[model samples]
Target chain A: MWRDALLVGGKDLRIEARSRVALAQIAPFGMIVLVLFAFALGPDQSPLVHAAPGLFWVAVLFSTVLAVQRSVAVEAGDATRDGLRLAGLDPAGIFLGKAAAVGAQLLVLQAVLAAGVLLLFGARVVHPWLLLGTCLAGAVGLAASGTLYGALSAGVRLRETLLPFLLLPVVAPVLLAGTRLWQSSLAGGAPDAGASWMRLLLVFDAVYVALGVVVFGPLTEAA
Target chain B: MAPAAPVPAPALFLRGAVALSGRFPLLAGVDLEVAPGEVVLVEGPNGAGKTSLLRVCAGLVPLASGTVRVLGGDPADVRTGVRRRIGLLGHASHLYDDLTVAENLRFAVRAAGAPVDGIGPACERVGLVGRLLRTPAGKLSAGQRRRVALAALVARRPELWLLDEPHAGLDASARGVLGVLVAEAAAAGSTVVVASHEPELVAPLATRAVTVAGGRVVADRATPRPVSTAGTGVADVA
Candidate 1:
């Protein structure tokens, strides 16, 4: 299954290796979100630190959605979708490959935005590595949900318009939980809280990955 | 020369398969048996469930109420390894518009875990040599794009090719090229299932043709079809 997932995901990454769609959407959107975050709350150290958890997570969530969707949209538009299915490979492989591609793209975007945030607002991550972990965790969530939503949207009329509605609702549990978890972790606010939220995120990751694999073929093939 | 090998019994067995979405039934009791190495051309009018049947056979679409078996295992089973041998060609061939032709081919091979170095021979098999290696997929003509797609099968050398309109856009010579490659694939013991409106292309490679209408199999004949003995529009369907 992992091999299959890698195969599908590799296809996406291999194509995006030369394609600029990832760079064009992911970097700019991430940077812009960071800019918006700076404007929304700034000029105070205590407030910034207090707000960092929510602010950072918010930045990660929205930007990742756009990046992930754009990645899947490429697959949706061309023969890539059918080819993957026809290759007689696994759908989970497709999800994983796509999720990983979008994940790597998110990592790059997050790094750039993190640098931009430091430069502009002097807002530095409490533990830079933890923030990276947050980005990674958040990425899995986005990819898991976005891949399925993207599949669903591929069938829906006007996918661009429908994706947000379909995604935001399904994506809330992870976004909210991830946001809260990252905030608490960053501030060292709740180290021993209910592991259920993060646990939920993990379970969401596993189930959604499987769901993406199972549903993607039909979801994409549907009208 | 010896006679062609007889197709083994159907590996994919669907018994009265019915797939429905709420009130709309995509298909009703579709009983299909696809033998190994059999060239079954699935035909239908638009929305007649040609794609639906292919999806079911490939184990992508779910049955509303019926049993579908791929090589004697449940199709919806995530662990069903039957997909490894089945190849489908549809509108979404997954070709990268921005990547070079060679890059796209290599990507498909690597992603599918098929041999990678076969790109050269695969390209040669599809007659894609010299003319369009460095060209981005965005710039390739429609016929060239189909060749790029056909090159996909060459990489895997799949045992089955489930195609939806394989010859949508091609000149007379181009059609002949497609027919030859298809016959070569089938003659090599591959099962080819194509759904198309082109009479010239189907008549040549088809061992049996099934015309589908209203989401059900209307005709299933095993008689030999007319080979492409002449130019386009000359091959007759029986």
Candidate 2:
């Protein structure tokens, strides 16, 4: 299973590297969203700083949709999905491999978004460890849940419009927990407050990851 | 006393298999049995479910009812590992556009847990050696892409070969290469089932011919020879 996961994950990452779609298109789109957030909230840096966590996650959320879309789109052409199915790898491994690839891409996106928040919003990081943990946890949750929904919507027409609707609602808990964790981490509040949200993110990640691994096979086969 | 000889299981066995696409039945009822080293040709018109049958055998499509056993196990049951020994070339080439021809074949072999050493020879066999192997699949012509897909299949050397429209995009030479490859695979004990609109290209090579219409098999016949040296003539199946 681990072998299949690494092979699949490596294949996806290599495709992304060659295509540069994530780097050129999705990442830049994320930066643009960041710039737009500042404009919409007015030129005042105070409002931007106050809304940094929400804006950052909002950007991540939207960009994640793009990333997931591209990831799934690569399989759309040809019978690539069927190819993966016929490879006979464990379905859980396929899920993990895809989620890992998406997680890796989102991490890069989040890193740039983080810098955007710090530089553009003038948001200072009070606890770097806490902030990094929240980002990693949130990214995992997003990748897991996003990949599950992506597979669900893969065979459907109008999936482009359908995916965000399916993914955004299901991912609300992650958004809520991620936002609160970011707020607590940046504020340097009591470690317990951050810990609670961190626990929430961890739970979210575990639940979706498990769900993805269990359901991906049947879902993909059904399609 | 002489020891009892063992009987080999059929490479593919389907009994009253029914499958659907949404509300419509794609395979209302399909019963087929293909022996080891047999080459079966599936011919049908558009919307005739030829592709779906191959997909079903490959375990890419679910059967609504009835039993489908490929390589001695239910293909529907993924844990059986039936899929690992099956190579399917469907309507799409299944190659990543971003990956080079060589990379695509390598990926397929690796994914199927086959030896990576087969890559070089597979490419050569498919006439994709040297610079062509390095060319991205997205840049290749339709015929070239088909060759690459065939190379991947050759490298994997699956026990069961399920090819849907195998001759669709190939030129005469490539089509001949395809025929040779299919013949070689079956000669080596692999069972092959090909669904083609132009059945004549594969007709002489087929051990059996099955025709599907309205989601059911309407005809099944045995051919005179296991390997045909006849010229390509269009089979009037439609």
Candidate 3:
């Protein structure tokens, strides 16, 4: 399973490297999302600073959808999904590999957005560990759920619209926990207050990742 | 009563198999048995369920009802055991657009647990060498992409080959290479099932022709071609 996971993970990352869709398109889209939010909240730095944590997570959330969609699109045509099914790779491995790829991309995006929050919103991180932990846990939760929902809607014609609808609601917990945890990690915030939200984010990540590995085969086959 | 004489299990078997797509019956009922090393050609007009037949055999589509088996096991089984031994070249080339032709073939071979070293020779056999090998699949012409798929199939060397419209999108020379490949696979004891509308092209390679209509096998018969003519003519074309 691990071997197949590495095979599939490497394949996805290689495709990303060649195409640059994630780096070129999706990453820019994420930055634009952050820029747009800052504009909506206006030139007042105080409001922007208070809203930085939420806006940062909101950007990550939206990017997760696009990343998952891109991941699905890689196998969308040429019966590539059917080919993978026939290739005999373990479905669990395929799920983990895909989620890992998305996680990797999300991690990079988070770093960029983290800097964006620091620079644009003038927000300061009081507890670097808590901020990092929140982003990592939130990214995994979002990636796993996004991958699951992406596969569910993969066969549908309305997947473009359906994915966000199916995915956003399921990943709301990550967004909520992420926002709260980020808030607690910011300057003039209580670091100890984030423990519950951090645990919540971890639990969310574990549940979906486990569920994705168990059900991805049947889900994709049905799709 | 004396024990019944034992029979070798066919490489592929379908008994009263029925498959559906929504309200439409893609395969009303298909019963087919293909022994090892027999090249069976599935000939039919458009929308006659030929593609569905091949998909069903590959376990891409589940049978709504009836027993179906491939390679001595259920193709629908979740285990990769049966799927690993089967190779399918569907209408879609199944090549990742971003990856080069060589990368696609290598991935397929590795995924199928075949030796990756066969990729170089397989590419050469299909005439996919030099710039074409490094070209991304999305950049290749239809014929070139078909050659890539054929090369990937060759690299894997599956026990059962399910090809749909194998002759489409290929130049005469490339088609000739495909013909030789099919013949060689059969010669190597692999069971081949080809679904095609072009009967004349597949005539020399197939040992039998099975006509499909409305998702059922309407006709099945032998087409015994002289080995010397098929081999020599295809060789000359190649």
Candidate 4:
């Protein structure tokens, strides 16, 4: 299973390296979303600083949707999904590999957005460890849940609209917990609540990742 | 107690296979049996369930009610086990567009747990060499992409070959190469099932012909001459 995961993960990353869809398109789209949040908050730096954590999490959520879509689109071409099914790779390994790839892309996107929030919104991290932990936990939950929903919506003509509908609601816990944890990590924020929200994020990640590994094979069969 | 004498099961066995797509029946009560070392051709018009027949045999489609055993085990029950020994070249080439020809074949071979050393020879056999091997699949023409798919199959060397329209996009020379490859696979004891409209192209390599129409097997017959002799004029068998 580990060997198959490595092979599949390596294959997906290589495809991303050549295609540059995440680098050229999705990442920039994430930055644009951050800028748009600033526009909505107006010229007041105080409001932007106050809302930085929530806005950043929202932007990452949207980027997770796009990243998951891109991951599914890799298999949507021709009979590539069928080919993968026939390739005899372990389905759990495929799930983990895909989630890892999406998570990796999400981490990069979050870093860019983090820089944007720090520079543009004037928000400073009081506890950098808390901020990093929140981002890591949030990205894992988002990637795993997003991949499961992506597989559900795959092969559907309306997946473009269907994915966000199916995914956004399922990931609300990540968004809420992520926003809360990010809030506690920022300056002049509540530090005591950080540990609980981090726990919530971890729980969400474990549930979805486990569900995905067990169900992905049967889901692909139906898809 | 001594183990029972090993008996070779039919490479493929299907009886009363019924597959449905939505409300419509894609395969209605089709029964097929293919022995080891036999090359079978499936011929029919559009929407006649030829593809569905092959899909069922490959275990891509779940039989609504039937018994199917490919390599002596029901593919649905032992999916990865059955699939590992079956090479299916469907209508689509199934190549990753971003990956070059060599990368695609190498990935496929490795995924199938086959030796990657055969990739070089397989690519050469399919006429993908030098610059062609380095070119991304998305940049290759339709015929070239098909050749890449064939190369992956050759490198894997599966025990059972299920090909749907195997000659669709190939040029005359490539078509001849495919015919010879099919014959060679059969000679080496691999059972092959091909679905094609141009039966004449596959006629020389196919030892038997099966016709599908309205989701059922309407005709099954053996070619008059041996497949190894470059036989001709068996297209009308169906």
Residue A40 C-alpha lDDT in model 4: 85
* Tens digit of per-residue lDDT, candidate 2, span B1-238: 9989987899999899999888899898898899999999998888988888888898888898998999998777779999989998877888999999878988889999899898888887778878998889999999898888888899899999999898888887777778878877888899999998887788888999999997888999998766754453222110
Go through the candidates in order and give each one's DockQ: 0.42, 0.80, 0.78, 0.69
Quick one: ranking by DockQ, best first? 2, 3, 4, 1
Instruction: Identify the leading candidate in terms of DockQ.
Output: 2
Q: Write the per-residue lDDT of candidate 3 for residues B1-238, one digit (tens) a residue.
A: 9999988789999999999999899999899999998899899999999999888888889989998999998887658479889999988889999999988988888988889999998999889989988899999998888889999999999999999999889888888888888888988999999988888878777889999988889999998883222742476674
TM-scores for all candidates?
A: 0.78, 0.95, 0.96, 0.95
Error of 3 at A15 (Å): 1.1
Which lDDT tens digits does candidate 2 get at residues A110-151? Answer: 999999899998998887888898889999999999999999
- DockQ of candidate 3 is 0.78
What DockQ was computed for model 1?
A: 0.42
Which of the two candidates, 2 or 3, achieves a greater TM-score against the reference? 3
Q: What is the TM-score of chain A in candidate 3?
A: 0.97
Better of 1 and 3 by TM-score: 3
Model 2, which residues run further than 4 Å from truth?
Answer: B1-4, B228-238
Candidate 4 lDDT, A1-223, residue by residue in tens: 7777788888898999999988899889988998998998899999998899999989999999999999999999978888877777788888899899889888888898899999999998998888988889988999999999999999699998999999999899998998888888896577777778888889999999999999988888788
**Per-model RMSD to reference:** 5.2, 3.2, 1.9, 3.3
Residue pairs in clash, model 4: none
In model 1, how large is the Cα lDDT of residue B174? 55
Over the full model, what C-alpha lDDT does candidate 2 score relative to the true structure?
Answer: 0.87
